[model samples]
Target: MAQAPSTRLAENAETRKTRLRLWLNILRTARTVENALREEMRVSYDQTLPRFEILAMLERSESGLRMSALSEQLLVSNGNVTGIVERLVQDGLVERLPVPGDKRATLVRLTHKGEAVFAEMADVHERWVNDLLRAVPPETAQPLIDALTTVRRQIQQD
Candidate 1:
């Protein structure tokens, strides 16, 4: 037997409300984290988190990543990523190189300066995470990370 339509509608509405609440709370926390990172970057390093993220991503990638790939990884629109990449290119933190086999394609690689910046940023980034997480005991923090990862994986799977 099929379930009634109204029951399904009510369930969906409740789920949507619950999801919105969760997202709102998560956004609030993220904003706080961003502000803290921004302060650290500006006051201590004279760099922004986005610049750090781009350099860090390049540092971890062997040959580097394509603009499209970087957009996906950064979860930003292609145009936005392009603009950031252009700025970094001008700053000499990154350079775009021809994809030898693909004339139409290009890959962005970190320069020596970018790598140095990334190394410095990484140390401060780790300390930021430690300071943020230290407020909660490891037992509590570990479970939170586990739970959040589970939820993120489920959402991504969908």
Candidate 2:
């Protein structure tokens, strides 16, 4: 026998509610993990997550990134990037070079000191993340990553 329309509608509504709860849980868990990592970075390196992230981005580039590009990549305001980059410059960990042929633009890159510092922190950061996610079985890692990737793509479409 076929199910009634009302019953099917109720089941669909319940599935949507379940999906929403899962989404909220994902957001909450991410926030918690990020807060923990932020605290860890603050206490261990006396550095902010943004600074570490900036360094990581620069480290990936052989040359450097434009100031505006950095801001865009970080999804932050230009002022925010400027302040952090200024501090990093004072620390001698990063440098800003005038972009050739563009007096209005500058490129930011990690210095030798920055590179060495990031290498050390990156190693520990990986270990920290692994520790935090240790409950996840190794077998499930790829599937979990794939699922998140798919979710991100779908969200981006919206």
Candidate 3:
């Protein structure tokens, strides 16, 4: 016996609903984790996630990066980046230097103080992440990582 077209359509619709629910759940979980991390950073380091992000990126780049590049890497707008960089400069944690041969551009880099502060924050951040995921079995770690990686690649391709 062959299935009717209406039955097939119903099944497809059900599958789509289930997929949408799963995607929503994934986003909720991610947001919860981020919130927890943000709280920890605020209480312990007196810093916001975006500020920490900028320092982290600058720390990784020896020669620093252009303001536009930092904005791109952080997936934020240039205006937002400018505000953060200005605050960081005022705090003496970062410096903005005019790009050689580019009068209209500036490179942002972490100062020595920024590096030391980031090092401390990085260590605590790692610990917080490990604690957050400690409930999961060690055996499931690699599979979960691989699945998320695949999901990221597929979505980016789209």
- What local distance difference test score does each model get? 0.87, 0.95, 0.93
Can you rank all candidates by TM-score, best first?
2, 3, 1
Between 1 and 2, whose TM-score is larger? 2
Provide the lDDT at 35 for model 2. 95
Off by over 4 Å in 1: 1-22
Model 2 lowest lDDT segment of ten:
1-10
Regions more than 4 Å wrong, model 2: 1-4
Pairs that clash in candidate 3: none
- Per-residue lDDT tens digits of candidate 3, residues 123-156? 9999998998887798998998899899999999
Candidate 2 per-residue C-alpha lDDT over 1-158 given as tens digits, one digit per residue, 9 for 90 to 100: 97779989999999999999999998998898899999999999999999999999999998999999999999999999999999999999999999999999999999999999999999999998998889889999999899999998999999
Model 3, TM vs. native: 0.89
Which structure among the candidates has the greatest lDDT?
Answer: 2
TM-score of 1: 0.81
